[model samples]
Target: MTAFPLLLLALAILSEVTATVCLRMASAGGGRWWIGVVAGYLTAFTLLAAVLAQGMALGVAYGIWAAAGVALTAVISRLVFKEPLTWVMSLGLVLIVGGVLLIETGAAH
Candidate 1:
């Protein structure tokens, strides 16, 4: 836990979510092109694999990564993709964050 790998995993998840949002935004325009989106996702996947190479368990890493990624992607979609934000969506995001917190707490044991 005191290793650089965990940080890398977090970073990879962040980058992955950002890339996903960017991809969505690009698709909305159809004219904006998607080379950046492609590059971002490629980099994200590579970094994720690098973190995995450092011996993190797949289940733990993937669960935290997916949950955090979804929450962050939702936020980014609202901001960058001009997606609407309802109270329900906001509450959902909160629950996702809470669940990820719980999972991480369990991982510490």
Candidate 2:
């Protein structure tokens, strides 16, 4: 993938991860936290659309986006919320990364 679309995809992943984290925070903290959730998701979707418009295949783009989001969210949540990050979970993350890499590479064929 080109740098621009990849950059947009990265941003989209970050936005989605941030939004998911905000959602959890909002559940506990309430109030203005909801704004972060909304803004983050909006930004994420917008960037995702831009990535698609850049001619990225949906399967590849979404695979990368979702896998990265899940991994980042899990790690971030563990750091921020003291949530568990067990060995099994870590293995799953590694597997997810591998899977996304496969999807991305296969898309080139």
Candidate 3:
């Protein structure tokens, strides 16, 4: 997890989160948002592949990417869409962060 791969991973997570938000909007009758959904997902996967090509382990990279995406999407959705953000979901986010940290630590050893 050099800086470059880390940066790509971050970008991938952001792209995925953006795509998910776009999907939500599209489902809620914003048809034009679909283009954003498609483009965001394509960019996300491309950056993910680039991260893998940068020699990062799949499990570690994907674990971090997925966890960060979920966490960010949930928080952003709550803020942007006025969706629920209960204590249980917050706890889940904490757990996801902890899990990602464990995976990253394990990969370092």
TM-score of each: 0.79, 0.96, 0.96
Over 10-94, each residue of candidate 2 has an lDDT whose tens digit, in order, gives 9999999999999999999787889999999999999999999999999999999989999999999999999999999999999
C-alpha displacement of 71 in model 3, angstroms?
A: 0.9
The reply for model 1, stretches above 4 Å from the true place, is: 30-32
Per-residue accuracy of model 1 over 1-109 as CA lDDT, tens digit each: 5578888888788778767766776777855547767777788788889888887767678877888888777777777667888899889888877887777678778
Identify the candidate with maximal TM-score. Answer: 2
Q: Which 10-residue window in model 2 sums to the lowest lDDT?
A: 25-34
Q: Which pairs clash in model 3?
A: none
lDDT of 3 by residue, 14-60 (tens): 99899999999999999999998999999999999999999999999
Q: When superposed on Cα atoms, how far off is each prediction in RMSD? A: 2.2, 0.8, 0.9
- Which of candidates 1 and 3 reaches a greater TM-score? 3
Pitting candidate 1 against candidate 2, the one with the higher lDDT is: 2
For each candidate, what is the lDDT?
Answer: 0.78, 0.94, 0.93
Q: After superposition, how far is residue 5 of candidate 2 from its true place, in Å?
A: 0.2
